[model samples]
Target chain A: MQDRYVAYAIDITDPDDPRVDNFRNLTNADRRPDRPGGKGLVIGEGTIVVERMAGTRFSPTELLGVPRKLNELQAVLQDKNVPYFCASPEVMAKIVGFHLNRGVLAVSPRPAPLHYDSVLAGARTIAVLEGIGDHENLGALFRNAAALKVDGFLLGPRCSDPLYRRSVRVSMGHVLRIPYATIDDWGTALEALAKYDFHTVALTPQHPSDTLADTIAVPKVAFFLGAEGAGLSETALRAAHRRARIPMTPGVDSLNVATAGAIAFYERSRLTEQQAK
Target chain B: MQDRYVAYAIDITDPDDPRVDNFRNLTNADRRPDRPGGKGLVIGEGTIVVERMAGTRFSPTELLGVPRKLNELQAVLQDKNVPYFCASPEVMAKIVGFHLNRGVLAVSPRPAPLHYDSVLAGARTIAVLEGIGDHENLGALFRNAAALKVDGFLLGPRCSDPLYRRSVRVSMGHVLRIPYATIDDWGTALEALAKYDFHTVALTPQHPSDTLADTIAVPKVAFFLGAEGAGLSETALRAAHRRARIPMTPGVDSLNVATAGAIAFYERSRLTEQQAK
Candidate 1:
């Protein structure tokens, strides 16, 4: 299915058609992926995101877009056996329950969950997140991780579903490409990191502490990042090889969690460059 | 208004009461602080933001919040001639046109904007933004600037108002405290940077370019950050003392504008620490 060369544009004139049910009422939480009534169908929105989905395990089962967007994405659609459900902008709005400015979307079945080992394989740098419940933050972290060269994500606990529609959209579809796995017990995850020869650093806001500059030069490291308010749990903190702050101004609150992560990731690439020289 | 010890808890039972006009119909863009009918009032939401306003020039004309939130802020409110307009949650929601989970809001007339001279004076490591129109990015950049020790912002043409309601809220009210100036002409702004002995670096995604690590150590420096797609103009690039790229994984999109700024800010502090050592 990943190597086809034809575009099948199916015209969708009615909003209530069952064939296009996957794209309906996206704003409703229950109908969105991972929600109670939803079928755990992963969704990719916009032309760029739809193109990104072509490179991931979360293949687009079907695509919905206006004719113009479908025509633009014809090359990308060739690889998916994509049944492009073409609709006028008005029909698309009614089907989605809102006017999606991106004008294109794709739906996929949630792929089987990967284990920690699969995520840890060949990973030199990773983000082990604790209690990251906001979808935007979760998504932004994935995007930052992708750009800054973080190998993957090891989910600790209380993280929102990374493949949720909003997360996929916010991540610019990188969540589907960068691998992740949820290891329920923090202790077990720490053991796995150790087994994988990964040096672990827990990122915290507490200052007068060791800064990232003090500890980021190791060849293999996993930076553990926590949520905004309540930071890393005691188990997560105690298990880490070391704790480091991102070196912030005195008296100011910590940088946004995702921003802090970007700084950490950027530092890794930077220090790595310095080392190579 | 900056120095006082009084809290006038005015009870506002009716949402339509003209006395609390500043906080009413807040969802409508026209009624928002910087909009046409908004009178350019700088608004700070939540207790932390409202408290942060006390330290900035945007003095609160009055405050509207539920009794519980008002009581929580009583000690902080003592610093201002704060007329704490108290109302129930339902009444407050009706007044603001949404359910405010933070439950507190402060409104202040937008103070006269600072000029480049005032913002650039005594500054080191500032973010000179060009064409950043998103309020959230503007607000996040301010918050990042504050947390990461960026001294101020120099706004180029096409930038949005940092004093917008959403920007204020997103900055956690740091938008009110951090100084910024709109320097209309790019050439003049470049000359001013040079006049202040600032080594200007235009941040861009183009590779084989100098990295932030190459030039962040100068005593006085300003990083020119551009919008996401249409990055810094050729004129901005040519004017800089150097051009720096925040090192990233190739082929991945550049980091979000605000996140990139944070990395630059973090690099400054890290290098400064190294210099001290």
Candidate 2:
């Protein structure tokens, strides 16, 4: 039988300890994933995200939290020999440079990014994002992808790092759960998607186009979404096999990109479920 | 012919003028719509939101911006004769307490909150929210509502004020575009909703209930969503006429309540569109 007790579960009294250095000044520049020289470590806050991180490609190398969190993760920590740097709330806050309402944080090195071809290989319904600079929007999109059972994500140009700390926090850590890859070739990646039989549908409100529901029955599809205000580039939109609209009342501006993606993903999922039934 | 000239436009060089105090420290306590001493002013940032506010119930009482934004709104500003508190970018930033990237700001008092009965009356589909304290999510939901054509919004207990600055900013000013009201009596409001022949559809993943597509055909429906972490409270859930779920993968937490609402609203809109066809 495996030894149920964990030796690495050390109670830390000092916030200055080097053991939890990976978590220091978390909200500041040195830890900012998009910044140069930043480690871009995969951080999981709270038990749920930590538990989720445990099951993903990004494995936690260290855990920092209150003792209660250690108790909660005891079952998940049974096999790992990684250090659990448990501390008081004050100590943890001092180490992290802010009060963490989630009470625990797990830090992991980012795994290698997936190749565009590899991520697109099995995805039946994928979200292709362009210039989505907001970390929360990027994270929220990942959360939506995971919940709606979207196959994966494709990163377009000008998009922010999905593994950034704020993205990880806002996505409720679904950024760790979903697979994503950057598209360096921009519109050229449309050819790769087409080769895989994905109907590249550009989501835009520019002029009359097919409504989202009309695109549901298409066998396999990828919705290309641009940043909220300035949508897909003309080159990118031209690359798409088709264009679709969310069908709004005449005068309102388009929906936020993530919200639009959610509706698109939901439509695709509905079709798949209906087909299954 | 109307004598059209730029002479009516006054460009100011000062930031501390009392005329612009309504737009000062905007992201703070006194400007908060929910604060006790809060003036409950609805603020619009950027040319787009400013244009929207021009036609919304929250009429702009004061306008502050750079030359570019003032020029963009010149036609809309023609007849209003409102104070165009113009400034250079540097001065505008000092007044608003931040670098105004959107380049313009319009301040308006909150329109009277809609009557609970009035917003719901004659509505084919709407959304009811409870304990949704996150302003961004609330704002995103309104943006989604505008896109998906959800008729209006009904707020239950503990929901944050939708007119909060962050919500307005995150919603891209859709809060000004959509009509919404607070339901003070909690579950008793469900009875009033029923009187309007509305089916109160609780959006929860817990129940192995009807899928959203299956229920979208209901003539009059109100989709109820709760906060992100804790879903619909027992009272909110029990008060629902039916529980409908978006089909999602097992063990995954439900989609963000606002995203879920978008899907439900989109589903209803799609159904209505199909019937119209």
Candidate 3:
């Protein structure tokens, strides 16, 4: 099975093939953020994301695309026995129930989500978001998290499903690359952060707060952010070890929560770079 | 005209009422990027955004909402002659072609765009975007520009209309507050910026470039950002006085254009603050 290049190039002509059942009802299947079962599959669109999927822990079990993308992705499929279901863009659209301009898509079964302890075991910097109900924001937070080298993400109450189609697209598929887990217990689950020697900093606009620049000194840290309009619950804010602010202009609502998170992550990276120097 | 505060509120039972014509086609109005009159009007949704619209230079000619929102907006409209066309939520939904959960909407005629010289005259820092065709990215850039204290925006080729509805909403109505204009002459516009003593910097991820942290000496600067996928044109990058990067992790595409812009704005702000101290 691990010999030379080989991909089962299945020609899919029928839109209603049961083999492609998981890919149907895509519009509704990708909605419903609250149901865990609704978000079981990790989707990768386009050749780059598919290639990335091939290399990551999340292996692509099925590839659905026009022949052009199949040829484009052949180099990356050399080692895998994955099925490449070639179909016309029209047939592919009918099977997926929508037009996918990316021209190709791959699907991965969900692996066990990384456990909190395992994710935080040796992490120096992390991001925790609460009530970030918007898929784009959640996706952006992951992109920023990956760019700034945050070790992982901790999702709190009311976060949208990270595996949703819009999120995967907006995140440029980074949601799959960056690890995350839920923390419904708020402070109690957050207290475990302290056990990892992480200084949990609550990012807020209120006073009695240190600027992000001033608070990046802790060796291990986790910056907490809430949704943009309805921010962190008071309990979540009070439970953090320190209160930090990004030092914004007066009268402006805080930067979009993900933008604020990017700044925090950048500041933390600055500390790591400085130490290395 | 000043005494119009006591005017009777009109009830609109019909969705197709001509008086509410400015609010029609919420979806298609903002579709085109190149045409001058593609979008119908500057739209502001929700109370906070509506209030911002009232406070800004964009004048709201008509409003559609439930009576409760009318009550909430009383302070902002106390003296305006404009009629608040109060309707039941159902009627309002029919008029707008959808149920606007914000429960209120305001439409403003586009104001004469600010002259480049006038908008640039007193600015210490500015943002320039090229080919940022996504309405959400354009809007979120304004939101970040506002929060980070970037004084103004300069639009280059292929950028979407900043006053488009989704852009306005995503910017939290900051699109109305921040002044922006299209630059027709490309690199020639860099000369006008030079007259204002702006240190023009092009943001790119390419190496052998100055890091954003290293480009902080100039008190007045203009930062250039490209669209998400197709970044700055070669001519745009070449015309800039300098080039800089935000220092991202390996194997990641550049940050979302707005996120990258925010980080650049943050770097500029941090430098300015440090110098002030």
Candidate 4:
């Protein structure tokens, strides 16, 4: 019987080695093909994210790290045959164009895009994002969604690519684990959700008739969230079946969009638990 | 009667001018006298925070900004007698050690520290921090607390200074408006909260027998939260009247401490709204 996981360790001392080009200048946005302005590979940082990548459908084609990180990830890589380029901390930093304190990185080609229907197949709770252009917010939203049992995400128009490097890192590699799809046609997406019996709740700070807690007791919920300052566009808000608010103080500004989403997700989880009880 | 609000603009082109010294080297941690390690001034950046400072008890002794921001903030600074040290963007950037795109700043001497009793006075909901040493998290927690109507903050041992520049910026200047105090003795502080008829709930990911929603109905509630990775210490957990959790998925790590606190705060607000209805 052949071993299922095999890690080929290659030691490269040279910073300019062509073999390590995939890991070069990771901080440079222009180098990332996955970003809106650039064309580069998807990259994962640190041992934990690398381990997650190994388990996800988005398989890492290559890895670069120091010996310690390699040792830390040995168990995760045991069955999967992947090239692990091991280098000294100094050499690794020089090659990556930054001092990566995480000390390990995994690079994977973009996978085939998941369809909205495929991602929503069995999801009872879903998050819909519009114009969430900030990478950090996008990542944190994914992290919150996963922790709160939000089954999947559907990106509306103007949202940033979740596969962006910063988003991947901020999501703590959960972006690779949770399935997501882009909604090219907002109206069609809403129609599909409605057809699936989803209670489409638009989260807005302005003119919300219902509080988030009041809207969570449903069979299936799809929350529509927008960026912090310019909340859900009029078109997006009109498309939803209901409008819900998190219920905040009168004078204070709305909560951070990611935090607001987490609160909504938590409310949904709480309602579900109560129902079970 | 003379108008109480007046803006005194002093044009400063020289970065070395002594009048603008308080805003100099804004990014250098070593120069901050307000921090544990340094003796510097409390700084507020951008027009919104400056406006907040003008309204708060921590009165800005001096302010610096560009002409455009000065015009935008005229109403807020109209009654305050604080000197507005106007400067060109280039000079301001050179003095502050970076390009402050906000184009405005205000510096205030650390005001007399508020006693825990004073901060807790007339407060129905409050957040307590233990071992929350991160500036960004501390700031975000304050922002969430304010927006969610958590009236005050009580800092336990090992908590970072909420007035730090990064924290102030991250809080969108809410730290200035929200009153907080340091807990010299956790035991006494807990006793004080009890004396004031407040239910002290310690937020912990481990051994939490109750969910947050179950514990929010008391006349007053004080939520005790710890740092992200370490969570609430055993001593802190044992000190509280109850241990509560945010109810997350099984396999994922606990939510970010600030996010967890926001959820807890939101739950408290939700329960309060239900009671009112």
Instruction: Identify the leading candidate in terms of DockQ.
Output: 4
- Candidate 1 clashing pairs, residues 3+ apart or interchain: none
- For each model, chain A TM-score? 0.95, 0.94, 0.92, 0.95
Question: Which DockQ values do the candidates obtain, in the order shown?
Answer: 0.86, 0.73, 0.70, 0.88
Q: Taking the tens digit of each residue's C-alpha lDDT, what string does model 1 give over B160-272?
A: 88888898888988888888888878987887787889999888988557988787778988999999988988888888889899878888887899999889888887888
Q: Each prediction's Cα lDDT score?
A: 0.85, 0.83, 0.82, 0.87
Cα lDDT of model 2 by residue, B236-264, tens digit: 88888788989888888888877888888
Worst 10 residues of 1 chain B by lDDT: B1-10
Candidate 1 vs 3: which has more lDDT: 1
lDDT of 3 by residue, A1-277 (tens): 4332257788889998888776776777543434665757777888877887787767899888887887788778877788888888898889888898889988888777677987788788888888998988888888888888888888887787888777887777788877777777786566768778888899998888887878779789989899987888898888888899876789987888889999888888876777787
Is candidate 3 or 4 superior in DockQ?
4
Error of 3 at A89 (Å): 1.9
Ranking by DockQ: 4, 1, 2, 3
A best-first ranking of the candidates according to their lDDT comes to 4, 1, 2, 3
TM-score of chain B of 3: 0.93
After superposition, the stretches of candidate 2 with alpha carbons farther than 4 Å from their true spots are: A1-7, A11-14, A29-36, A186-188, B1-16, B32-36
Candidates in order: C-alpha RMSD to true structure: 3.0, 3.2, 3.2, 2.8
Candidate 4 lDDT by residue in tens digits, A35-132: 47665578999887888898777778899988778778878888777888989999998998888899899988887788888878888999999999
